[model samples]
Target: MKKILGFAFAIALAFMASGCTMMKMGTAFIKLEPETQEAYAKMMDSIDTYGDPAKAMMIETKINDDVTNDDAVEAIKAITEERNMRVTGDVKMFTKEDAAPDEVKHARIISVCNLTTAKVFLNHSRYYGGFMPCRIMLVEYGNGDRFLITMDLTLAIKGGKPLPPEMLKAALIVKDTMETLIKNGAAGEF
Candidate 1:
């Protein structure tokens, strides 16, 4: 009995250590050079200023230290999977030097929306409060290049309902605003 308890304890300790390691890794920030960090900061700031008509509604952009681009992608997938929303898109990268005029630098745009929700709920699904999904946009620039990624996220409703069209529109506007900042050389200014 003593030997069995000792083995069990060892297993528990190992499990705990692994869990801790995973948590640490998940919470860690992606390492960026000083210039890169500054550029990101400025680009975010420009989001509140440049993008189309919504620029007036733009407030100060907030940067989340714990929220890495990879984590954002995973979180959206995990959250939507519970609600039967399958994330199907990917982040596409664009460099400034290679991009055309009036283009963005280091842009990654991911589109994650629920076709299932729309098919099931139709127009009435917009009334569901938590059903309005989210889209996460991330942009990184360094070594004289910029990158951006966007992903859609949503929650499952009890009735298999979808988010409202207006909600989706707003999310798109926000993304466009970010793109505008990149186009205006916000990355270089930072």
Candidate 2:
């Protein structure tokens, strides 16, 4: 009886240690302005209607003028290559949206990228048991040359759980990257 109890305790401890939300990152949440929130929502809707991702999970986007220029594109490409992400399709961008001004006051574009993580297979049964983060970059050239843009990152947790810290860190990175692009005018292209 004693050995059985000890074994059970050990197994429980291991599971607890392996659970998600154990990874360490920066803060847990990142706040956004009301306008930013609305913009993000609209972008998500577009992704759903246009991209049709099976799990359109994490989304991160930024609105900047020519932000996807050589440098910015290279940065994103590097992340994809380093992470071994399979680009499901070529990056697609929309010239305009439903709510855009009739006169096309600003340059509004939407770009989409897809990536995947490891999958778990058990006796011929395959399952999505890892975290696949999805990112969307939205660039909007507002009036006065003020760029209103943001990135939305979501973790498509399937069969397994995701560490809160890791998710938070990824989110912060997306937000910070958007802020940087806006401040510098799309990789300092301004």
Best by lDDT: 1
lDDT tens string, model 1, 1-190? 9999999999888987876666666444343222444444444565656653333322222234444545544544554455444555656555455644445445554444456444444455454424333333445544332233222121121112233566455434534433332222222321
TM-score list, all predictions: 0.33, 0.31
- Which runs of model 1 end up more than 4 angstroms from their true locations? 1-51, 54-63, 96-105, 120-135, 141-190
User: Each model's C-alpha lDDT?
Assistant: 0.43, 0.40
Alpha carbon deviation, residue 152, candidate 1 (Å): 12
Question: What are the per-residue Cα lDDT tens digits for candidate 2 across 1-190?
Answer: 9999999999878876766333422122223232444444655777778795432433333434455444454554455444444333334354443333333333433232222222221112243222223333433332323232433332222112333455445434544543443344345333
Superposed by TM-score, candidate 1 places the C-alpha of residue 67 at a distance from the truth, in angstroms, of 3.6
Residue 180 Cα positional deviation in candidate 1, in Å, after optimal superposition = 24
The worst-scoring run of ten residues by lDDT in candidate 2 lies at 115-124
Measured with C-alpha atoms, the lDDT of residue 187 in candidate 1 is: 28
